[model samples]
Target: MTETTIRKPIRKAVFPVAGLGTRFLPATKAIPKEMLPIIDRPLIQYAVDEAREAGIEQLIFVTGRGKTAIVEHFDTAFELEATMSSRGKDLSILAPTRIQPGNLVTVRQQVPMGLGHAIWCARAIVGNEPFAIFLPDELMIGSPGCMKQMVEAYNEVGGNLISVLEVPEEEVSSYGVIKPGAKVSGSLTEVVGLVEKPKREEAPSNLIISGRYILQPEVMRTLEGQEKGAGGEIQLTDAMAKMIGNQAFHAVTFAGRRYDCGSKSGFVEATLELALERSDMAADVRAAIKRLAATFD
Candidate 1:
């Protein structure tokens, strides 16, 4: 098995947590949707965890007005920690929430722009180096985590790479589908083209671009003068499409389950599925699920 050559170590990662998260309202009315927990940890935490696992050093959060909670989640809760310490309760539980000093960075996206604009907001912080992007709403579940797998692949290939997963043909219209070039390996495919939310028949393939991406800094230049393509928003897909031929773009077919927590159904499914996987909660969650199903019957 080949190992990561570390051509350029991925140091920074951007988390676009600026969206209003209207789908999960009024719950999200007061709280950021990224703060909504899957079981114990918030969605953004999972993304950060993945980044940390992948050896990312800097965590950049592109945030909005109401998203302060997202940043606070990673900070040290002194009062809570003191209370826990005084009570002699297990303090290690807070370990996952704690980020190392000077590692966490925040940049604001004042308007509710598209994902591309949110990402571009962090370009100054990202400098000239390559960075990873993580959409917190997409709860990717895997043993090594999604970003770790992508980092390993990125270390090997050292170009642009987006995590792709084959969704159903009927669902192709809902996602940015990739026009595949060649199957480089079982899990790697050269991305010749990208069609954002293409009609099912017009879709190049069933593979949809998932939430994770490792992009070159040149993309920032492409997005600098980029006009809105779809929905009058600066779409990342449009910028990435322009970089296809100029750069080596590929897709890493995700070998994990992705829970689209952006939608109501997906949120509930993620909560229940993750809960059931927990040893402490599984039995009770299973019984509760059976009881809930009985009401419908």
Candidate 2:
């Protein structure tokens, strides 16, 4: 067999966790939405863990007000660790969760402009490096994690690789839809064009862009112009669309389950599914679910 070489260009990752989770109301009033718990771990933790798994060396978080709790969550809590150690609790449980030293950096978004603006805020820190951007609100559950899969695809293609999934026609209006080009491989499609929040009939394709992306740094220049697109917000997709023919852009259909934790129904579903997957809560959770289902029956 010929040797198959994979090139990994993107090492740093930018996570935009500055969104005001007004949808969650009182719960998110004092807490950042990224800090909301999915099951035992916070939503942002899953995004961080995914980035680390993809061999990302540096983690850049673009945050805003009321997001200090997110910074503290990843930082070393010496007292808490010491207490857990003294209690003879399994430290390994916390090992995979903690952010490795010196690898994390946070930059303030300052303004709630948009996803594009949030990403642009990290331009100085990102410098000239091609990096990954992950939205923690889209909680992905799988053996290899969503972004890791995208990284694997990125190594093969060496250009912008986005995570995409097919949504129902009715749901096309809720996402940035792609105009797909020639097929490259299984679950990998060449991106011809991109449209943000297009109506069902106007959608170029059924494929919807998810939260994971391995983007080239030049896109930063596009956002630097700060031209507003949909909803009068700087749109990353609009910037990315400009890079289409100039660069190699493709979409990877991630092999995993994605939960939109930003929505009420999605959050509840993720919570219940994740809770049921936990050994500590699985049994009781299944029983509770069965009882609840019986009530509906």
Candidate 3:
């Protein structure tokens, strides 16, 4: 039998930024959660940057109320650009961050449904193309972005790819766990099953699902009639599970540091660790850490 070639290119990426960041509280009251700064750049910027690095041409944002700021952030601000240019400052730094004209699109999700619903909001834009979905809250840092790694895996396997990371058994319940199948290659596994937030004892594997996803267009049809799963929300994983028999599903164990920016403590840890890696901040952070440790002693 001849092998079938995957025709669609993963050009478009969907970002579900409509959530009311209740966890962040008062800070998120006016500011959209995606705008919350991880270090100097907003959380959404990192996700967008990751997508662009992964060769995504169109950035589709599924937004809601108070999310206009996110749209504006990616757009060029004439006043700011002019001011910086006049001051002889490096303007190129802002250029890559700005989404190229006509490449960025925003669709509003009126109701706070769920991840699945947010993804479905972009159905019109995604059309029949195999696209990517990124969660800004899952901050992945590496030489090549997590999605790019998954894209490479997709090219090899020619199927739907989800980024998975091996977590301790105790932490498996905190994330969606994937059941292992045949080992396809190094860091790539054929996914037989997926369990969302399963208890440690019931977890099929230690490989917990992270944010990066390269999905087939057919999954949208599954979401169209899919009911809510897990926390009474329309979970994307539920729809993905439906595609098991019909589609080729693979889990790519991403080689990167994933920080769950959705949680307060995780965000702080990411900030500190990322900051420590910077040449400018390394010495200062190290000195401060040493001082703090000495105080505890």
**Compared with the true structure, what per-residue lDDT tens digits does model 3 show for residues 176-241?**
999989776898999999998899999999998899899999989999999987678898999999
TM-score of 2: 0.94
lDDT score, residue 174, model 3?
83
lDDT tens readout by residue for model 2, 168-234: 8899998888999977699799999999888888999989999899998998998999689778889
RMSD of each: 2.1, 2.4, 1.5
Predicted structure 2: lDDT? 0.88
Better of 2 and 3 by TM-score: 3
How accurate locally is residue 293 in candidate 2, as Cα lDDT from 0 to 100? 95
Candidate 1 lDDT (Cα, 0 to 1):
0.90
lDDT of model 3 at position 50: 91
Error of 3 at 144 (Å): 1.5
Residue runs of model 2 more than 4 Å from their true location after superposition: 1-8
lDDT of 3 at 276: 93
lDDT of 1 by residue, 2-117 (tens): 33444667999999999998988899998999999888888888898899999999999999988889888889999999999999899998898898899999999998769899
Q: Candidate 2 has which clashing residue pairs, if any?
A: none
TM-score of each: 0.97, 0.94, 0.96
lDDT of each: 0.90, 0.88, 0.90
lDDT of 1 at 236: 92
